[model samples]
Target: MAVAATPSAPIFVVADDHPMVRDALALSLGAAFPGAQVEFAGSLGETLMAVERRPDADLVILDLDMPGMNGMAGLAQLRSSHASVPVAIVSAARSPALMRQAVEMGAAGFIPKFTPSQEITDAIRDILAGAVWLPEVARDHQLAPVEADLALRAAQLTPQQHRVLALMAQGKPNKVIAFEMQITEPTVKSHVTEILRRLGVQSRTQAVIVAQKLGMEPPAAKGS
Candidate 1:
């Protein structure tokens, strides 16, 4: 019988826009992997940078609602760019169907935000061991078929397109998105066109509705 091999310098990354969440994940992972190197990224861009900086990373756990990710689009980008590195979704959304979709889309696992720290550490270990980590009962948790369909549609978008869609979901005007993204209005318009086309919706409201159903929502104002 062959023994399992653990990473000699495992680099586990926890990507989330929320600072506290990132810190918590880091603490749990640090304890679980002991000598493992853990990195923290706040957005998809940072996550990609982390990937570039730590090519030897063994696993990446990301929040689906993080900035610039546009949901599962970030997951697809990571998998496509770094096929050798395993990725997982750690988000507030807790739908079994979404978890299934993420695994189907190439994620090593789906870890919901509510998961206890101990369980999360265990999940990270299992994924590092080359096993799929999922809630035992989520395998049977029923979801509307539309959720899975939307998730697949979401996977088809480019990373930039996903960011555009995210801004639209926040009800940000094109000018605002342009200013925030530092792109020309025309470029933003182009992204919107593709976002609408890929989402199979004619307008932004409808597009936002689709994402909301998938548990994608803009966090309330800082003090709200």
Candidate 2:
């Protein structure tokens, strides 16, 4: 099903690595909206693919701990790539703090894994209606300045820059990063330069430091 262009039917991409969790979310979306179409992806990679297939996706329910997505990077990636879609995080470890950060990074909502099916539906509906749906408690906790800055910086890195930064964090040189990323050395150098510039760092070490501190690993950043 395509992401909705009209309210008559909406499409939701529910991303989680766990099969059971995916099934549960699909069921919840199905039950909540009789005509809604829900698709499932086991990880952030799959989620991105699904979004590519349906760039007009109405909403996305993402797993916070899905493989390849750490901290706020996955949320950032999705928000940046699919700016029109309203995305939300669904996690077993939901918290007021994380929710605030997700919202600050551009999430449309935050749905706790423990949220009842009814509330989940309500939250999704609210977001689709152009409202920011978040837990009441999350409104009280704002990210510290450093964390906010980190989240913003991570969000700024493109997928290739993220990959280069990740390898650099492990102390890999340009040659190794190019090999691992299956790109040319010059491309790797370009990525490194962009990474440093985006992270506001003067050098590789500083870029890695900033990336790791900001949790900049996206699923595709594992190299080409």
Candidate 3:
């Protein structure tokens, strides 16, 4: 009998409101796998749009306290819309019950917000390898569960901005991205400026944090 083929390189989408966080994550993922493809979404609406556009994405890195759509609700929405896509929650809210709930709601794993960059990548790699990404805290807290319903709010984004954000998350320079995407460098810079404003960050490094909190890769050294 023939053996099944190994899974392809995983594609990731990060949903967070921090520019430095997103930038950091994009950098980290790029460094980790060299050619791995990664994308970013600053809000719930953008997150949904990304999934719709790239339904075959291997995984999603989600955050808990986004501006409009809370992390839990977004997770549920994603579960409902794309039941097949795997999800991993990366958040600073260290609630055991919530982590368990996320898993029950179809999340493949949970990465604590302060986890090292390498750990984050390791979790993604584990999930991609068909292993669970839950921390020990989650397993222990599963016994005593608290009941809470996190609500999600509505948000919107322009299609053009969404595409620009996706390319930016791939670690492309403005000029190169503009050329490849058929837009002017000035336009690309404007989109990036708008991204920082909407995400409420001053620098790209800060955006990376937000991205990592959302489960996206960070720009720092793998273990640093």
For model 2, how big is the CA root-mean-square deviation? 5.2
Ordering by TM-score: 1, 2, 3
Error of 1 at 209 (Å): 0.7
Ranking by lDDT: 1, 2, 3
For 79-150, candidate 3 gives per-residue lDDT tens digits of 778888888888776755556656766788888879999988888789888887788766744434222221
* RMSD in Å for model 1: 4.8
Say which candidate scores most in lDDT: 1
Pairs with backbone N, CA or C atoms under 3 Å apart (clashes), candidate 1: none
Query: What global local distance difference test value does model 1 have?
Result: 0.77
Candidate maximizing TM-score? 1
lDDT of 2 at 82: 80
TM-score between model 3 and native: 0.60
Residue ranges of candidate 3 with Cα displaced over 4 Å: 1-8, 141-224
